[model samples]
Target: MRFAISIPQFYADGEFDPAAFRAYFARAEALGCYESAWAQEMTLSASPQLSPLEAMTYAAACTSTLRLGCVVFVTTLHSPVHLAKSLATLDQLSGGRLEVGVGTGGPQRPFAAFGVDRSRYLARFTEGLALTKALWTRDSVTFDGEFWQLKDARMEPKPAQKPYPRLWFGASGDGALRRAVRLGDGFFGAGSSSTAAFAAQVSVVREALAAAGRPAAEFPIAKRIYIGIDSDAARARQRVNAALAGIYGRRVPAIEEAAVAGTVADCVAAARAVAAAGAELILFTPLYEVPEHAGQIAAEIIPQLG
Candidate 1:
């Protein structure tokens, strides 16, 4: 199984430690278990978190071989032109080591705050995705889109990766999973989904690919799993719950239940279930005590997986 780790984002005001952050990547690279490092996006949140692109750029500078990306940018809330330009620039800056993940950000998001029409966000998402890809690959683009339009537009300095970077979709429902198969290079299961639910989603993705006459082997599948490791299982559970609550702004029982926490053996068993559920790439995201969890997971859990 391919293993990846979440790049550290949790920070307090005036508490950003450059040395520690750089050290985290350095250590992960030295361990030789991680193929990539990922960041998550939350444009408007109660938590103080760095922007995914900025964090990813910093990570790219710190580590040479580790691929960097964001799990899902709320595409509906963004200006496609600006977002596309930024991602293309990031891909170039990272020397083509970029994977783009996007989603509609759900109906619950504060759409009005971002000037998004809640009812028509999905259309905006799909159109925006098309526009972004066009900007990346097209030399001069002329397009008429409902949300955006361009006439003979030229985007210089194309991405380092040919045909642009890989696009991964963060989706849950059957319809969205099918769209992932239709439009994205991969499907990324959310951290909030239970193992059974994730497995079901994977089934839908595979079926969609089959119906589309696309080979499943060409489209990768990945999942972000909230995880923690501690000998005292109860403590691990408590820590993960508290962390999720802080991130989500409330207590979500489903999210708490979905997290993997406890001893090394317990985590191994849970990760095995994820692999069995069809997650070729498992992104281990520790919400609290990140460095310690990263170290232990790389040293203990990854070896056990192999």
Candidate 2:
């Protein structure tokens, strides 16, 4: 299984320390424990955050080989053309070490703020995905769709990865899982989802791929795990809950249960269950005391995952 980590981005006010951020990447890259580093996009939220693209770009500049990505960029709320170009440029800047993730983010997003009609958002998401792919892979494109129209559009500097970067679709529902099988290069399970839920989703994706006669080997399955490591189980759980509340702006019980917080053995068992659930790639996202958790994971947790 492949392992990864989350990039630090939840900085508020004048709290961002550039030197510390650079040091984090340097240490993470030198460890060679993680195959890639990922960020999350929160365009509109109470959480003070940095944009995923900018964070990934900065992290890319700090490391020579570590891949950088956002797990899911609520593409439905963005301009496909602009998003595509930005990602393409980032891919070039990072020397092809870019992973592209997209998701509808469900109907709960503030669509009206982005001038989007909630009823037709699924259509918009599908069209936007198509348009983005066209922009990335084609020299010239003429397209007419329900939401977008373009004639002989040209996007310079195609992504460094041939065709495009690995297209990962973040999904939860069975229908969405099927859609990922139909359109995405891989499926990414959200960190908020419990291990049981991810197992069910993976079953749906696998069945859909089998029905479509697609090779499962070509489609990677990954999940982001919210982790808290400490010998004091109760304290670790409390810290994880508090950090999650800060990140999400409230206490979400389901997500709290989803987070793995306890002793090292407790974390190992939880992560093993995820791998058995079909997550070939597991991204460890330490909420608080990131560097300390990273050290624990590298020294005490990861070696035992096997």
Candidate 3:
């Protein structure tokens, strides 16, 4: 089973320790077991989080072999041209060690803040994705769409990887999962989703791929698992719930329930269940004590899971 870890992004005011951040990546890279590191995007949140792109850029500078990615950049809220250029530049900077995940977030996002039409967000997402792909693959692109229009535009040098980087889709519903099969390179189950739910989602994805005549091996499946490990069971659960609250900016019991918190054995069992659920790549996300979690995952947890 391939493993991935969350990049530390939580920082309040002057709390971002540059040396510690670099050291974290250094240690993670030395572990040599992780497939990649990913950051979450929360452009409008009470949480004091670093922007995913900036966090990823800093991480790329710190590590050599480790790949970098962001999960589910809400494409509807972005200007496709600018977003495409930035990602293409990052891919070049990172020597093509970049994975791009996109999603049309729920309808309740503050669309007005980003000048997105709430009623037409789905169209915006698909069109923007298509435009981004065109910009990445085409030397000169001419496109006429409802939201974006480009006439004979050139995105320089292209990405180091042919046909752009892998596009992973964060989706929940059946229609959206099918859409992911149609457009995205893979499916990424959310951290908020329970293992059973992820299993169900995996079934849907497999059916869609079968219907489309796509090989399951060509489409990778991954999930972010919120995990808290400690000898003190109650303390672990409490810390996990509090961290989830901070991440979501609200008390969400269901999301909190999705987290795995307890002893090392408990975590190993939980991770095994997730693997059984069909996650080829399991991204362990600890909302607190980033470095500690990475160490434990690499040393204590992953070894047992295997």
Tens digits of per-residue lDDT, candidate 2, 1-306, equal: 899999998889999999999999888987778899999998887788899999999999999999999999999999999999999999999999999899998999999999999999999999999999999999998999998899999999999999899999999999999999999999999999999999999999999999999999999999999999888999999999999998888999999999999999999999999999999999999999887777788778788876
Q: Given candidate 3, what's the lDDT at residue 7?
A: 93
Candidate 1 lDDT over residue span 132-250, tens digit each: 99999999999899989899999978888999899999999888999898999999999999999999999999999999999898999999999988889999999999899888888
Off by over 4 Å in 1: none
Error of 3 at 20 (Å): 0.5
How many clashes (backbone N, Cα, C below 3 Å) per candidate?
0, 0, 0
Q: Per-residue lDDT for 230-293 in model 3, tens only?
A: 9998899999999889889998999988899998988999999999999999999987788998
TM-score of 3: 0.99
Worst 10 residues of 2 by lDDT: 291-300
Q: How well does each candidate superpose onto the true structure, as a TM-score?
A: 0.99, 0.99, 0.99
